[model samples]
Target chain A: MATVTILGKELAVDADGNLANLSDWNEDIAREMAAQDGIPNLTSQHWAILNYMRKVFEKEGSAPSIRRLTKESGVDTKTLYQLFPKGPAKRAAKIAGLPKPVGCI
Target chain B: MPSETEFQPIQKVSIVISKGSLDGVYPGLIMANGARMEGIEASLFFTFFGLDAILKKRMDNLKVATVGNPGMHMPTLLGALPGMSAFATKMMKKEIEKIDIPPVGEFLTMIHDSGAELYACRATVDMYHLKREDFTPELDGIISVGQFYEKAAGGQIIFT
Candidate 1:
């Protein structure tokens, strides 16, 4: 496990840097996490997908995979890549303070 | 002592599907899909019998390998029986569905929609006299072996 500091509060993240406990998630934490990932600013599109992911995770107990995210998040694959960079599901889930999604590679 | 970490980044991956059977197509699909999900460019080349994989009607109707398959766990004699392969395919499909994994057709759509390029072998296309109409609209086009190499250049090329 690794740790990320958000709002001066330290929280443990999984090996992939996704938050291990969803309760530690909030907009402030998400902003910090996004900054850590090289994005100093979060666009409305990023927040849309992140909030959708967080909502689904809070209800389902797991972050959505890229497949589910692309299908239902109203974000196309190319746009998701543009916003999330290296990997959408992993990065978005991390910023949303959700655990790593198990379904993706 | 060498460090335990190496940061090798994959810019692209070309996955070749040589077999059309259900077992054969999935590996290439999974790898390419994985690469695309990782934000790496992915390309798929289907050759020989594997061209059946992209055929609009047969792509989703592939059969599990039963005949002479060591992993199938059945006697060779039983493996020769009709419907055995279909039965195994059914069982595999059910399990895959239970895991929320998309079926073959839907998976292909997902990967294609995700920006992964799909190609078919020109030799196979010529031999079969196959037209573009024979395949799914997602088919990028039929390319020669040399063209495949060109496309695979500067990327990890995997033969499956």
Candidate 2:
């Protein structure tokens, strides 16, 4: 397990699943998270999304389908899509502190 | 690094809609709409004054602020003077409608129709004396700040 500090809080991230250097991503996510006070904690749901984003990046080197993610995560397809303006994989990946996937631009 | 070779799929996004003004509301709506188009699970937690846009009666009245809002640029400024605010709002409404994007009411309706979760802050609801009926019928429910945070974990969180 690797620890990353975000918004003055430290979070434990799975080393095996983490993308790139853990510290770098942690700082970036911390800054992003700190921008808003409305969202306070990191939950399993958030992690599941992040993990999925990383997996998609690794496989296709790009974001995956909302249809596939909805089926996979069992979340509503529309709700899933709304979470990432740039697409689920891209937005979630950025928030998860993972690197930008290929073909995202 | 070899570690970078692995890929991940993003599953969710958490957004906070804080400004109720027309300009303020657009970013949140646009982002939320964009997210839906991409198939990501997204939620918007409306707090403080931001609740105005979701309120049944006030939604259509959302206006762009000309004087103090730093985010308002040239086109928006030109649109806010004299009768321009109304004209600008009308034009914006027309453009969105042309693209089949719903008005704030319908846009939000589509969001709910698409299964996007909407939360009105409990504190704000009480502060404003807003009954459940005051908001759009599609609201998923009201949540405390803590509850909102609990839901925001792990995914990307945005504030607009």
Give the DockQ-based CAPRI class for model 2: incorrect
Cα lDDT tens digits for candidate 2, B1-160: 5464485766678889999877788778767756655567789899987899799999888876665655546565564579766765776778755644556886786566555789999999999888998999989989999999898888888998
Question: What are the per-model DockQ values?
Answer: 0.53, 0.13
Per-residue C-alpha lDDT of model 1 across residues B3-108, encoded as one tens digit per residue: 5456577889999999988888888988888887777999999998888789988988999989888999899889889999989999998987776667888888
Instruction: Give candidate 2's TM-score.
Output: 0.55
Q: Flag regions of model 2 displaced more than 4 Å.
A: A1-105, B1-7, B70-82
Q: Give the clash count for model 2.
A: 29
What is the model-wide C-alpha lDDT for candidate 2? 0.67
lDDT of 2 by residue, A30-88 (tens): 33552442335545565666667657656766655443455576555455544443345
Model 1, stretches more than 4 Å misplaced?
Answer: A6-11, A35-45, A76-79, B1-4
How many backbone clashes are present in model 1?
0
**Highest TM-score: which candidate?**
1
- State in Å the error of residue B34, model 2: 2.5
